[model samples]
Target chain A: MKKIKQIFYLGIKGSNSFLAASLSAGNKVKLSGLASFEEIFRSVEKESSAAGILPLENSLSGSIYEIYDLLTDSKTFITAETEVRINHALMQKERTGLQKIRYCLSHPEVFRQCRRFFSDNPSIETVPVADTASAAKMLKELGPDTACVANPAAAAVNNLRIKKEHLEDNRNNYSRFITVGRKLKQHGNKISLMFNLKHVPGSLYKALSPYARLGLNLTKIESRPIPGRLWEYLFYVDFELNNGKHGFDEIITAMKMLTKNLKVLGRYDKYDKIKNS
Target chain B: MKKIKQIFYLGIKGSNSFLAASLSAGNKVKLSGLASFEEIFRSVEKESSAAGILPLENSLSGSIYEIYDLLTDSKTFITAETEVRINHALMQKERTGLQKIRYCLSHPEVFRQCRRFFSDNPSIETVPVADTASAAKMLKELGPDTACVANPAAAAVNNLRIKKEHLEDNRNNYSRFITVGRKLKQHGNKISLMFNLKHVPGSLYKALSPYARLGLNLTKIESRPIPGRLWEYLFYVDFELNNGKHGFDEIITAMKMLTKNLKVLGRYDKYDKIKNS
Candidate 1:
């Protein structure tokens, strides 16, 4: 039998990261929790875990910006990708009625998703906690008058009752997670890379023209500022190639000559299904 | 005598928006406070105020995403722009020492800017409040063991003693603010616009080539997702035009033909100096 792989993610049980790590490829996967994204990357660097899972972007919120910055600065590469549908639940202790709840606690991002819910219940005060699962844990300790907005999995793990399900205003909420490892894995059609261009007119256009010339489909383009350099940006681009890696080397060579500090972050297959089991 | 213009901003006295509103070009600027960004925009639309002041982006924390989304969705136009240097200070009740500060309250973004301070003092718990000024107001009511991270103006307004000045990790921290009004102001060197482009290989490059071809200097480019569209993005671009609206009409006409849903958000002069008074 193959040995189980150790995977580390941010937050405790019933968190979105936990769910994402569980879905990552491995016959027998052992998931561990870390306090911050920095610690997760450090653990991967230390070789304590085979891989680390992190949320890259959300369909509702534009991007998990801190993760983008970390990916740009770190040495790790994405090995795989997965998507999970976010379904937030309003949970509390048993026998707590809707009118009895006065405060709602959860992650700040979670609160943003449930804006309409809070607007409907104007009396309930929003309290920002560490994460969704920890908020559920804290809600269990608090009085019956308090509730938490988290996933149903978190409510079950913390022994709380779900008063309202699918509290997010948008029903099509989804988040994309990436598995990070030490070495680059090359079994995918999609490639993600980051590069810096000079602050000049049409510099980005010239840098991105290679994709169009080569008939590759560009999926996403995001720009983040370089630390200490005001107005200078590091552009992250994701593209899909249907053909084999025939002209990939030449394209990358030409791209490097056109742009500065070009780094290929990952080449991974895009996974969109939610594997709850 | 010229009539005073009523300008609304976010937060109470001594907030960054308050300072930005004061800098608006009016004979006598009558500044008012609003609880949220939506309220400020609504007040501007209702004609209760001549304009609204809002922070567009920060050098450290990137863009104020909500404002970006609001600008894309609303019909309001930018009248002026200003830059404010962020100098966060740690403050508490009279004579409270650093050791006595068991908890520090401020906006989540402010906490991010002061990461080094919190890492050095790990024992101090960070409490997320509404905003920096409100945190100072809350700290005044809380016990003496609590402190808040805000600007010196907030500390002075709330009667709190500044224990440590310049708490932000980066000394060059600055935020750009824009004044929003019903009509577009003409006296400006910069023009900001937003448009949507298809997810094609050279879609963005083609949309931006007009600027380069017309000898216009592009200042900034940011992309935000369209609400229901999964992969499509609305690109926000800022460019400087040296010639006085000479070829601007032709450029806009060509840009509209190349891009989808092109909208000119504003035209305003860029302000970079610190004008606290």
Candidate 2:
């Protein structure tokens, strides 16, 4: 067996991150949880046997800004990616009728997802908790009337009774999870690059010119704000290599001239850059 | 005065959104609250005399993703921008010591800001609420032991007493707010443009080149993900016009060839894009 491959994720077990990590890890893998995303990245960069699964973006919620910030700050690379279908259910201490539950407890994102459910039951008061796991604990402590929106794992772990299943407004809700590693794995054709551009005029346009000149197809382009520096943004771009090989070197050389600092984040095959898009 | 200039904001009275709107609006402005961000956008676009102030980016938290998504989906343009200093305090029903508080309640963002306070007092169990305004309302209902992280306005409006002030770790926390309207107000040197490019290689690079040749400085470049169409992104850029006057016509003509669809979002001055950044 491969000496127990180590995998890290945000939050403890029964979390969405944990669920994704479990689904993505190989045989004999030891899954562990980190308190913060920063810890996960730190461990992944230090240990070659380790990898981390982080929620990059949710289909409904857009991108997780903190994850991108941590990724840029670390020496890690995106090795793989996966999607976790977010399934939120209303759980309580016992089988209570919808009318009996006065308060609903869950994360704010969970509340956003169950917008329709809350709207339909105007009498039910919605209270945002930290996360699903915490919501479960709070349900036990905060009295019987406080219901929680949870995933299957959270409900099972906490031994809470499910009052209703499929509470989320949309059935197709998903969060795109990306696996990070210390070593750049040559597992796919898509390459990710991040760079800081000069504040001068035409710098951004000049920086992107090389990729356009080489006829490279960009799969993604994202910009994250720097904390203290408000005007300048760090650009992250993911593009499929020219025919899965040539023209990468040329593009890098061209980027070096335009950008103050640039880092090749990773190169991997994107499982499905989304089917319809 | 000035026909009671209408300004729309997110959330009801005694909320952070309301606070930002109040600070950003001009004299004789009649501010109104909207139930949802979508409603604010719809009202702003349909009414010629109306404008809505939406939170764009926070210095510490980064971009507000939902606002960006809504901005792209609507015909409204960003007409003005401003920054509001975020101040959070510890409030409760009584002037009880921190030791008396068993449960700390507030928005998750508020909790994040008071990380130091929480770590120092590990016994305080944090319960995240919808927002500061709701947290204040909950303090009246959820018992006196629950202390809330709140703004001064929320405390005053909800009749909650302040226990501790300046609970936020960073004194430099500020949120960038933008006023959106139907008309593209051309009051500043900066111009905002958004475009959806074809999936073909080099399309984005080609689209940005005209500005580079003309030496127009790009102040901002943000990309928002399109739901269902996961891979495709809408690029929003703010570039300073060449010498604050020329080359805009030439760049627009070139962009027409490369982009599938393009919208000129607006042109207005950014009130201090952040001094240090």
For candidate 2, lDDT tens digit of each residue in B1-277?
0132899988766677787777777778898988777889999878888889898776555566667667877988888777777778888888887898999878886787687889899989987877777778778887777888877777877888888878887776777788888876645766778888657776677777777777777766766555556546677777777665575666678777877678787777757644211
Residues B1-277, candidate 1: write the lDDT tens digits.
1132888888798787876665564657778898777888888877834788998876545566577667766768887788777788898887566787799988776776687899899989998765677788888788888988888878778899989888876675677788888876655788888888887667877787787677776767777655457568778787787667445677779899999988888988766565442
Q: Write the per-residue lDDT of candidate 2 for residues A1-277, one digit (tens) a residue.
A: 1132899987767788887887777878999988777789999888888888998876555566667767878988888887777778888888778888899888886787687889999889987777777788667776777788887777777788988888876665677888888877655777878888657766776677777777787777766555566557778787887775565677778878888678887777767643210
* Native A-B interface contacts kept, per candidate: 0.26, 0.59
Query: In model 2, what lDDT does residue B39 have?
Result: 86
Model-by-model DockQ, in order: 0.39, 0.52
| lDDT minimum window of 10 residues, candidate 1 chain B | B268-277
Q: Which ranges in model 1 have alpha carbons more than 4 Å from their true place?
A: A1-4, A23-27, A59-61, A107-113, A169-174, A224-232, A273-277, B1-4, B14-27, B59-61, B108-115, B168-174, B225-231, B243-246, B273-277
- Model 1, span A153-185: residue lDDT tens: 787778888898888877766777998887776
- What residue pairs clash in candidate 1, if any at all? none
